[model samples]
Target: MPQLSVIVYGPNTQGHLTELLDSLDAHPLADAEVIVAAVGDWARETAGSHSPETIVVPLPDGTGDAAARAAGAARASGRWLHFVHAKDGLPAGAPRLIVERTAELDAMDTPGALAGPGAPDAPGAPVDVLLFDHVSTTWQTTAAPSGDGRLLAAVGRAGLPLDRSASLLRTAPLLGNRALRAAFWRAHEEEFTTDDEPYAACAALLRAGRVACLNQVAHEKRVLRPESLPPLAPEDRLALIDRYESLLALTEDRRAARTVLYDLMVRDLVRTFARENLPDPVAREFFHRASLAAVRWRPEGHQRPAGLEGVRHSLLEEGAYTRYRAFQAANRTRRAARKALRSRKRQVSVKVRDHQYRRALSRPVDPHLAVFTAYWDRGVACNPAAIAAKLAELAPHIRRVWVVSKENAALLPPGTDHVIPGTRRYWETLAGAKYLTNNVNFPGAVVKRPDTIHLQTHHGTPLKRMGLDQMDHPAAAQGLDFAALLARIDRWDYSVSANSHSTRMWERAYPARYTSLDHGYPRNDVFYTATAADVRAARARLGIAPGRTAVLYAPTHRDYEAGFTPRLDLAALADRLGENTVLLVRAHYFYGGAASPLTGLRRSGRIIDVSSYDPVEELCLAADALVTDYSSIMFDYANLDRPIVVYADDWETYRTTRGVYFDLMAEHPGKVAHSQEELTEIFLTGAWRDESAAKARAAFRRRFCEYDDGRAAERVVRRVFLGEPEEALPPVLPPEERTPAPTPEEATA
Candidate 1:
């Protein structure tokens, strides 16, 4: 039989399993075998890439990992077994190290080393199983118990935890006892898996003082597995009770063991209860009773994890849980009632405005123009500002009206005639305007005129599904009527696209007869023309410190979630990046209606809320790096030739619920981080750019920024307003004519 068998769980779609296999192959252990338990046939593809002797077990779809682990253990043909979670791999030296330790544990020379698992009670039989870790370093573990008669009691009294490491164990104990195999399945069936098996198998062996420590690290672990805590199910609760009962019967000191188990189980339950948001009253009551039980029967005083001080206090407090639940129910009811009332009001308002929306068109359509970005009710600036500026300069004779929100009436530039939305003047302008332009869809209420040309300057190059393509998205398409939406899109006389990919996406998705300029985003046109003085001026406006790397952390809004959910912990991020990094945060216009994300922080020098910063182009010019998730702004930022890191912690959820056009994990313009730790590491080590994301950035530029010459605005003006043919546009100026970016020295100065 092979000396080592490695079992891997989860599909290897990310090729994490392949990495483990490569590591094992590089650090060869003679007769070592690999067993992969995966849900799909794709495992076979990964298995094929592994060593010749590797085995692939087709796990039942949706089978719990515990069951999959048991199945892999049964198929293993090794004296010692090593379990691997998918995201974590054995270090290159781990295979050789574990091999050496397992041999040492079985050696006859070692004091109290295992003499195999045969009748462990026999004189000189192995007294303890050796525990080790994957890395060279090991945690505090038991030394060999040589002839220690009270070793069983000592093992329990020591209160050592069997961490979820790639631990080595004798196959004889697992193989010889058919009851142990049954117990493994039984424990998993009872929702008592990792805890139950390790405890049961190790306890039985430790009775004969068979638990030993190699005083070395054996295997690595990562945030690869889903939470193994019991769900809000009756079976899960019973499973916990069953395991507790089983352990109570076996422990040498039931009181002490129960105390320890209760504390640990309560900590796990508290977290699960809060995070799982259990809706079942029966299960919730059961958990409440369990907490009471812990308080009533706990051997020692109670213990709780941090952040659960309130939970612990509530359990000890009289009638607190009841009152809290009642208050939550009442609040939920209040919210529902308010939502219904608001929905009714909206319906009434829509009905009342139906005639007037069309009546506004009765006025003569102004032959000149009006432009708004995003929405009529919105106060923001983006591509529209650049387009508005170019239009003023190129065709000043054409009457221009800036459509801004009432709240933002003061923001209109000096000498620029602006009309507040919803006013009578706004309606007259809407009726009169021969030209209308916006970066997003026009207000649904606005009626399209026959001769008026509406240009849709869509924001961003899409990575996620949008427009008609997102009709299938549950979250993205909630309350959305595709027919009406496409009708509005059809009204567009011209649609501005940032790139060829975007042009194709727009043409396929909209399919309306509209001229697509594909002239690149006007917002990024400055990147091509901005001189060093321009870059310096933008940096000065933003108040960036010398030698500081401005990392703009901009994440896209989730359509499914409500309000501005702060994904990045600002304080933690600031601390992680250190003082030299200034975090320039720009929120989406949807989140809190342009409110800065950094509201309540101590106003530390580290974080800057640049949401109100005029023209994001300046922020891009000033910043050294960008960190974003699922935001198409990455495509825009790539043109700046800066480093970008994708911190897509919820990539799976975002991809499935909202959907994406590409597998960003594989082909994002930057390294896509799955966790804050990895993201921080990348930023701190400067791996977020240059070394990690350079090649992808180049490719991204070619794909998304082909037509983003500084003269995009000029092209839009010449073609749309000046009535010039595409070929009749003036030649793009040489690079020297466009302002050069300030040197690093000048920027710092």
Candidate 2:
């Protein structure tokens, strides 16, 4: 008999299986037998040749992997059987981990704690079953570490389904018991979730013998096609309901029973399987029945929002026949209103564009024009704000009208003629303006006439990938339309670059033939000119306590997650830092949330969320230290010459997924904290301010800080806005020439 039998299932996964078999071949699996449980002859042919013994089983048409798993297991000759999805690859450590964990289970009197009572285990007894975890991999973040794998939760009804991630079982224990095999075969035939195999395996293992699991990762579940789980058909939904209902009937405990029913009703019935899902009368009736069964079981737990009680009450008390037609009518009206809001705004824009266009025709081509930074409505910041201020000093004729977004209009500085974007005034000014300067591109719809001088002053330097490097990368170019992006870039008359790195990146990424102004970033000008008194004043303005050190905790975002996932517990961090520190929580610009602390701790003023504060430069001025992950903000913060603590908990995931230009943890200026505990320890121990870190910061500055000198704004205005030559801007001086020479004796020492 074979030592181990590997049964593989192949579906729409065409190119994935060959690599899986290749990996298995690379690793010596001499004692294993291979079985390709294929839908057709193609998957088996796709597998090519393999070692040990190989068998191909053609599954019945119109069936899922569950049926194939059952059929494959019946024919396997190996004592130990492992089931793998053709789309997933076995991790190198899986075979060894299976043995170690199996040995550990064999030595135990009972299986691991979750195995429960009546477990069949005598010391030295062979393992009946072993389930392992999967490392969830996505194309966006391909490099995440292996250990952060998760098994299906035991709480939700959906949790009962076995994850296609990985499964290993003892053939004899599974095949010996008729009832167990029947239970599995029935569950498999139901063909509900992908985890049906595990659900069935759990049923069989519970009856036949003790079940053991290695929560350790032994395979990769790559999410190459992000939308692989297609919408459930009405039959698919009914199948899921049947599976959950059966599981509910079997579950003896109230909590487990409630959980099973909750998943069926709450997860599907009222949520996904509403009247909208398969609007068929039969499907709707099943959803209602499931909802009624769930509410009768228990209305609470499952961490569902208490507010949803009204919804539950409506469904349970009011019959399914009750039509909330008013809801549909009202939603349609609201949707129409939302769609019309933009049309109404654009009508006003057209009127204003004409007015502004006509008004500018009478007026001379005033170099004094509109300036925007970042998005349309951002306040005076970045290159535009700096350039705008310098223009007023040099030529007072320059009329600077700021275009703001209505939502972010509050952040715009007062005493300026600011027009909300899409407003009549904004459209007029944009159309009429002689010179337009913005860090980001203007609307692609905006026709950049030959007379207009458009300056593209981008926001920051990059260590992570940017622009064209991310053209094909989903994670980097999330929500961006590349053709539209390039169209906007094509409108630019001058593209400002902070350094050679940015220049090269922007030039390649934005292939428009715009003139490149290789001057340093104007945003960093504040760092050079800000005195001690300025820092103190900025701190006072933001309400940082006099004695407390302002620590700016700004973390970079992950592409895979929807928004910011809070890695650090805010309350715990504050407690760790004590009363001597104040934390300014600066989330990435894309995220928004409630004013409450991330930990849901009752509102305390120790940690202030500065994510809304548009001017990060002001935060930098107020801060004594910077704490961040892989954000390019660290590179900017280094110019402040303050302490920097890099807290990169998901470094491996981020590096593997996002692909950074440099190893941040190894090269960062200050202490590199792998966890919140270490970051807190650094602050508590005051090791964030070591002399070595200071020296590292100096080196980092030498490498990245070649361009900035407070005169960057003047250089940009003089060249692009004022029509001066690039050489008119002062040349970037060498470090030795820029700084005062050290004393001869000190230098010699």
Candidate 3:
């Protein structure tokens, strides 16, 4: 018999099924059977393409997920049964880890086992259940680690009686994160007849002989997109009351288990009541039904949880639905009043300085006035700068004023009109401008008028999670107020996207009603427009000697670290690459003003610090190759068709702390090196410019450089500044037809 039977089930049309199956193939188990419960013709067809050893069980049309799961379970023949949904996945090496842990349990002596009373405890007895950790991911959020870790950590690796670890009942709500012994499952098969997995999980926990916790994340649960989820019927929501009653009867004799189960039921009902938007009649009905269950299942001498929750329990026990509604309304009113008071205080604090700005806001917006900023007022650069320059030639009547910080004021062109942040001119310009463009968000204090057009020309293609997606990574979120962020995003009338991938990510992350202008990044237009002379001039400006190789080393910031910390020893790397090569090091903009740590190497003429360099387009034009780790610069550099290397020494750490949209190592532009030694070897061995590297770079360019052509800036200026239709704008040139700027070597040749 196989050690484990993995039963997978989902709707036939589920789009993520292929990803799930592919992950399983990449990380296969040695002694496990896979049973795919194909629910329709499409599912069967897709399953046929997978390994022939996988068992495909066809189900009739219109079958629900629960019935499919039951069918798969009935066909399962292994000693252990594990369930998986087609939209979910198994993490790498998780299957082997799970199988090994369960095998150990089977080999242990049965004496003194924590199996519950009446359990058969002969030698080689099977464990009732083995629980493991999981991650939950949604379209608008990154993967969030399960809270079950703390409870499971306390239970240790040893098997324990259900009563000894009754608190594990909190996690009994999820199904796919646990495995059950086939023998144990057969004994309690009748209890799982219901369609509700939570109810069945509760039943199994109440009756389990012995349970163990696997403290590793073995499953990846994909939360269906909000629009994809079907609304819960009134009957389905009400059925929870019946499930909880049945569970209460099962746990009647077990006091600790009964208390935990009761608390779980009440919490579940409260969450549904608070989160779901039901009609008034249905909501009242649900509240009435829930109040009765709360009163009936109240454990003796039970202490209600503290704060607003305890108050809610008291109201529920009284069966006062009207009073509960009133209480919720009053609380909302109090919160709104407090928020308004805070706003009023802020206004008072800035009233004197902002008086002229307030006056400007009341007046009609100036149709010819426009405002632009980039990198939080660093200087005029990026897509905003490109658009601003084009606007000057295309719509000369429109007055453009840039927002710059006092320190960066000198960096702007001598004749350029600009306003310093926090000054009266800055406030008036922001208030009066009918068109505003920025690469980053303006300060939260700035008011967005309805008549003003806001264009968000994001600086780069997203590799790391952004906007609402950062909610799960606390290090990345850094106490961000999502509500405020959304308010700012709401002001955007247009969001510029570089490619389809970026368009999808931005839509999901920001989730505003703004229209996406899929006209490639304007800043990257330089790649196609620059002449051979331009490339040589960029190289000369950066002090790259003729006939020498220049490698641009740009690394992204780490949210887990306090400040800039170089991951590579630049001196050692430059020495190894020989004096024929020069490194153009650019740190992330987050550490813009910090002193360079590579000053010694810069003095040696081996390293040039371009951390504060304007128009990174110039840096890309000067380099022969690009070396980066998780920086969006790779996406832009691919346009040049240069050899790109990913130096990811701390890839796992970065992926965990600051979640990424995709695995860069798997679909890299060129070669990937995990260590400094490997990186040096790649350059020395001429592998960086090999045929394999060219193929990777070609594929990467096709995907990312889809819309970038010489005319991107013209397209933006025509569509946005000139008020022309998208059809009238210039069409994008295909990659093969477009010519990127020549390298210094090609220019010199």
Candidate 4:
């Protein structure tokens, strides 16, 4: 049996695994064996081809990253364990280091049962470094001396050495050992997992005995794409606030929690309003209502740690209520400007006599259902498959489908003649849509129309908040006050999109009852298709030439309110593509309605602006490569097997400005580029040639999309059109048993 059971997860790094096997094959400890717990058949195949002697454990699909780690542990036979991802590489001499530590533990008359090589050294001796991190890789080293136990505990408490360096452990207890390594593991195995950074932090802190930090740069932490940084999502903002509160409570420190909470709350409020492309009328009203809400819900007693008093003090000194008043004043000015503009556009129209007799004589209707599908102004504007699926289900029985928008149009679904508009003629259009459904929440659609029943099929997955929207933001201080701005929002539709992360926000933000489902964009059904070959052939039939692989580079709009110009050097990008590869640049939907930055790309021989093309249609027949930053295209792209590259040059600023749904760097399985050169390299060479690319793809698929059997549209048709209950799919959860935290009510009670 192998001395160390190296359990690896993720398929993206299968190529890296091949390289790793070649590197490890030359190790001096030829006696040691390797065990790989792979996520898929691809991973297993990759590992098997390199080291057939290696024991391979196939992890269950849909078990999630954390569960895969636990499963690997359950199956390992080695006395010592080394758990990591395929993307992570061991230092040149990691095996020797682990073996040496195990040997040392074996040699001592009574060794410390849990001695790791890289932890801080004892006061007298030097600490052998085990883990070293670089710009893009991680290495496990073996060069730390023994350390005092108390020091280890202190460092753990302080949250020092945030990264988990490659750690070496003793298989058995040594100096005055309490229990064998197996026994120790059995007691703590439940605590181990691989759920991004925060979860990793929680697991590392909760378990482990006599932990050590090898300060050496054994690990090379790669620079992710600009869109991948500041991984916390809009929904995560609330959770992070709760986390800080928990940390403060653990330490019994009120000041610290208060400070962190205050800063996050203020920043969230600012970001919510700053990021929205609200009409002046809506923006003003939203600001007013938010200001009022802030004044009403004054945060009182959340604990705060001491050194962080400055945050709380600033809030007090600045006068939270006063800030809200200032917001209100600004919105008042905006409202005045909007009113003046309306006066100029207002046209006198004759009021028609009320035909009460004719209206009252109208035919009575059947049971009504309103569907609202809300979407961000990026990606494919509409999910046609979802719409078709819905239409297929409800066409004969359902009355009509009302497509709401900020601007009015007489657009209707194909094959349907029941067309309605929602711009300035919202009431007239809505009068016919008895059953209201929208992609996301547009309060304007349902707030006043009490007779219509509303059902929301949110356009995409939850990733961030929009407008002046957040539970933490005060109503009065709200930058985009929904109440005051109700008219503006109501102009579009009624509904909001949500996933597990932002589920609560849906209910909290809207006064009306909200519903959620597991289905993704109605349009994304194109990517999840049995007709992939057909789609490819369809593109061939179109002007898209044969033998040319397609690449879609889609980026979001800047709003210009964020004080940044929306620009991309398309010429530079086009110059980098291979002869057979074509680049499709999809600008943000809003940007598409304005001056486009894709002229340069369009001028190039292979690059084309897909701004006017429906994304689902384009994605179906047009892409072999995908490049995006902060847009939801990644989620849909995962349904296809094409490579994705994130060109997020403004990731850090965007996170600070609008926040994110998750950590892109840790979760996204693609090449991230911060510069044009990096973007070109990622698109041209790194995507396929780099061993780590495969692991990245695996991570992306697992997190953003899975179980795409090309029947997603069929599933939706069954559920929505047939009025089936949402039991067709299982709830998505990691395999690990998570301990649920207490709700506010439960804690108070």
Question: Tens-digit lDDT track for model 3 on 5-66?
Answer: 98888665557777667666644566888899988877877877888788899887778878
- Give the poorly placed runs of model 3, Cα more than 4 Å off: 1-349
Q: Which regions of candidate 1 deviate over 4 angstroms?
A: 1-364, 593-597, 730-746
> In candidate 2, residue 429 scores what lDDT?
73
lDDT values, one for every candidate = 0.62, 0.62, 0.83, 0.46
Q: Residues 399-454, candidate 4, lDDT per residue (tens digit)? A: 44445443423343455433333233343344445555555444432333444444
Q: Model 1: which ten-residue window has the lowest total lDDT?
A: 136-145
Model 4 spans with C-alpha error above 4 angstroms: 1-381, 393-395, 404-429, 442-451, 467-479, 484-499, 502-512, 561-567, 600-604, 688-691, 706-722, 728-749
Task: Please report, as a residue range, the 10-residue window in candidate 2 with the lowest summed lDDT.
Answer: 172-181
* Tens digit per residue, CA lDDT, model 1, 114-223: 33223233445442344432221112211111122122223331212222111222221221111111222232333323534444443443232334433322344433
Name the top lDDT candidate. Answer: 3
Candidate 1: what lDDT?
0.62
Give TM per candidate: 0.53, 0.57, 0.55, 0.45
Tens-digit per-residue lDDT, 493-564, candidate 2: 888776677777778778888988877778877877766666676777888866677789898767775434
Regions of model 2 farther than 4 Å from truth: 1-366, 593-605, 730-749
Lowest summed lDDT across 10 adjacent residues in model 3 is found at: 115-124
Q: Report how far off residue 698 is in candidate 1 (Å).
A: 1.1
Better of 2 and 3 by TM-score: 2
